[model samples]
Target: MKAEILYEAISEINPKYIEEADMRVITKINPWKRFLVAAACLILCISLSIPALAATDNSFAYELLYTVSPELAQNLKPVRETCEDDGIKMEVVAASIEGDTVNILLAMQDMTGNRITASSDLMDSYSIHMPYDQTACCQLEKYDSETGIALWSITIDQAESKLKPGDKITFSVSEILSQKEHTEIKLDSIDVSNIIEATEFTVDPQIRGGAGNFDEDSMECKRLLLPEENGYKLCDGVILTGTGMVDGKLHIQCKYDDILNTDNHGYIYLKNSSGEVDEYYSSISFWADNKTDSYEEYIFDIPYDELAEFEIWGEFWTCNNAPIQGEWQVTFAISE
Candidate 1:
């Protein structure tokens, strides 16, 4: 019974519905029919009592803050700062602050227990100041090297000093850059044919940067041909460069040739033209690239006259999470 051991025995019989179900329906079942439908849903969740269905729908903190910004997962506020130098230990647990954006949910440890790795190249050494502003532009929506934990988001565009709601935010980490050295690489296959190459784009909607920024003025930019598989090399090419349409949302940028350490992993999809496949509304918006090393601007709230012809693809995960196999794609058209 191996679908990863029947998903670890359905995560030990209903770990919050195997952590909120739908992992593409558990990787398209068929491990002995998903272990007889996970042993008949673990014998009907042990004759219906899984803690009374986790005490009536708790959505695991909005499914982990909806993987970042499902509108900042409504009214969240649970903080308990902690710190410790050198051997690392930091924590910020939770936070939220809509408007000028600011969502945090950090956690790090190694206090000598050893087993660390949360480096997206140390995420620019982290920051979120407010002793008088200037330094809020962090974004690494999720990382969990088996639980060192991370989910940051800070965007204070300073529209005349904004960030009020009992403001006292100061989540600085000065330096992290961890790695106690752990290596485990196992792969039987990951061809991805020949990476990918085929592009198209057309869209023009504009309003430029102000008054709510609704720009798309004919988005066109594409380039993605990364794949040095087997010998492993997940980046050294990936560029879709532009596309934006605020307010009604649908941004697409994608530039990465390096410096996008994993744990925020990556995978994008959106197939339409009647094939209908719009995985979870999309959401990712990292940044840090003065010329390579970071660029992920997904974020599709959908609504660009309903996007006509679509076909996006995915693949990105290295730096230990491994899964760099890819034929990442692209296709788009909407210029009636």
Candidate 2:
């Protein structure tokens, strides 16, 4: 065995090795110099768990966040950010592919020294969804342009797999050190973007519903989903309707004349002048005690774009109209 290699290996041993009686200074001895060093001190036999190329974490604990689907449009945003220090590695793999939804297999493991295991089969791995619609690519081969590899490797050169939308699967640590302590992982949030057909008409969905009850000078227009003062129905689709060509601002006049209200973010989506459906959070802000006698205003803004279809979504609670009111108006400013 290489003497220098053996020397280096000995240095990595825990401090306990130094106190052993009869053991001379490992002058030129290192574990890598001879596998026998491990065979002698540690008789544990670990098997070939995962593919040889994948790297596994050396530490026992890890954090993992798997984004289900990646938005594969022209404009892609950050799906999720992950970080690891204690010998952990992250893996991405393909889960499913249905129309536009792309599911991704995310895995975290103790990769101090071992192969990481990931699979395309949905039967065994866990995954998350993201907007990975490579539909904008003129050619199927352009996938590499979008991302060189489907799965991103946090530790080694090669990752387990590449992934697409709507796919399902479980990703796991194929091989890990038996001696590693504290083994586990976490999931964080994700970001997404859209694929645009036309540059001038991209579905800029995120900025929607931002500004609210500004200093009054920015207030522009107001209209209801229908002529009735009732708040817009979620699933059926109501428009913050009347506005300049730009998707500027949105306002809602709640007609629940009698109920106190607390606003929340809901599942709002968009359909541009182009017909593509884009979903975003409808940031609704309203007075908590809405029935306090003074008329309160609820404001939501849509991102500015030359094209869009504004819609509301997400969980809804019943609105009691004792201060019973009618027709609510939503409005926005026109952008040039």
Q: What's the count of clashing pairs in each model shown?
A: 1, 80
> What TM-scores do the predictions have?
0.23, 0.20
lDDT of 2: 0.24
Clashing pairs in 1: 204-218
**What does each candidate score in C-alpha RMSD?**
21.8, 24.4
Provide the overall lDDT of each model, using Cα atoms, as 2-decimal numbers.
0.39, 0.24
lDDT of 1 by residue, 1-336 (tens): 744344334333322332254331111221112212434432221221011212324345335445544434444455545656655566554554545444454545555654445443343434333423342344345555554554444343334455555445444444333431222221112222222222333222121121112233322222211212222233434444554454455555454544434323343456666767665243433334243244555555655555545555555433433222211111111010
Best by lDDT: 1
State the displacement of the C-alpha of residue 300, model 2, in Å, after optimal TM-score superposition.
9.7
The residue-level lDDT of candidate 1 at 68 comes to: 45
- Model 1 residue runs over 4 Å out of place are 1-88, 91-109, 117-135, 138-158, 162-167, 170-318, 322-336
lDDT by residue (tens digit), candidate 2, 37-123: 323212111110112111334111111111211122211212222334345544331122322222222333334533222311111
Number of the predicted model whose TM-score against the real structure is largest: 1
> Roughly what TM-score does model 2 have, to 2 decimal places?
0.20
